[model samples]
Target: MSKKVYLVGAGPGDIELLTLKGMKLLNRADVVLYDALVNPEIFQFCKDDVIKVNVGKRKDHHLKKQEEINELIVEYAQKHETVVRLKGGTPFVFGRGYEEVRFIVKAGFEPVVVSGVSSTTSVLESFMIPSIDREFSDAYRTITGHDMKSFSEIVTQYHSRENLVIMMGIHNLKQIVFTLLEKGYPSTLPIAILSKGTCKDAQQVVSTLGEIEQKDSLFFEQMKQLTPAIIFVGQTLNATQELIAK
Candidate 1:
């Protein structure tokens, strides 16, 4: 009955993707604060008497601010025997789970972290795209496509052997492609955008950087409908094409 907060990863959007430890903590939690991307079906793991709060944040719409969320984690921990903050994807992988843990520590509580299947690897692999192939790639960079300025700054060079997996980038797809082209990435560089990855409704579009650039703005507008998508660019993508063609 000791008071504690558990930061758990809910995996992509699949209830089956949740890890054993994560499920155990969810069942033990007296209060659960979950994000927008987490599958609400996960609540089935908790006792019917548990208290659940939705603190999910979306672009241009935030149900609760970061400070508010951190405060709630601490507040719940102080009052409840066990509190859970469940996030989509891996907690540290762009989900701001680290920030929550830091605040929890500052509040004099040591938080327990439960790892979940990150969308970065699972989502892309679900479509048969290998982040690393023995013959094709040696290194892969997981980056954020949300900020064009920082993205251009960090990805200064494009090596054929390296792969780029960009998250939260579907909205800025055209800009990202243009920036890469300006930075000397080949116009023929393969690009694949996988939407709602790991879910039953998952969809993917594979094309070269130049092909996307030549499309009309209307085409880009249509793409904005797919938000929670990952953009992968590299030679390994070509291998996936070869396999599919065969």
Candidate 2:
């Protein structure tokens, strides 16, 4: 039997946001390996006897290492007719999906990619914040906040016409804010931390770089509880506020 693997994107947090093709594949999956941020309700579409594995990671804590996950994908693909690797947001967007694809291809199996909605932009839109507005920003940059070194290197300076959408940045919020300040981002530059976007309990914290810098330890402590959050910085946020106010 020919071995084949499907890498599916589960969208941000809303189960409804899942694409039609993704949902159809999930319904027929014989085995599924899902991530931490994927909506649990999505599994409802799968068959009752489907094998489901939780290979999720959170804040430096990994349930299964990357190498282990790669091995499992190949192992399951060899046995199952339909193998699905479900990931939160899009697979390639900070999901380490390309690495998995590389390993699967190396194992001589066909790897199919099914694109889904990414939280980097959808989360911002959920809060009425455009990733890029014609009047405010002409472009947007998406970066991961998990690595401070890469972040510092890429975000050396601030651009008023560009927006920054940072994922997995809740834990390093303070450092990210300080780095922006050091990189010449204005102290009053508008920023927002969007959490659990598209879900019923979604929350947002709107503030400025200077204000966030002055936030007390208690504020940060509270922020830690809001994991799986996205940090947005740019003038587009101000534009969102102005439109909402009027």
> Which one wins on TM-score?
2
Cα miss at 192, model 2 (Å)?
0.2
Best by lDDT: 2
TM-score of each: 0.97, 0.97
lDDT (Cα, tens digit) per residue for candidate 2, span 1-246: 447799999999999999999999999999999998888999999999999999998877899999999999999988889999999999998889999999999999989999999988888888888887899999999999978999999998888899999988888999999999999999989999898999989999999999999999999989989888999999999888998889
lDDT of 1 by residue, 1-246 (tens): 334688899998889999999999988889999999988889999999999999999888999999999999999888888899998987888988889988999998988888889999999889999999988899999999999999999999889899999998888999999998998899999999898988889999999999999999998988888878899999999889999999
Tell me model 2's lDDT, rounded to 2 decimals.
0.92
With candidate 2 superimposed using the best TM-score fit, by how many Å does residue 215's alpha carbon deviate from the native? 1.0
Q: How high is the CA lDDT of each candidate model? A: 0.91, 0.92
Please give the range of 10 consecutive residues that has the lowest summed lDDT in model 2.
Answer: 1-10
* Candidate 2 Cα RMSD (Å): 1.1
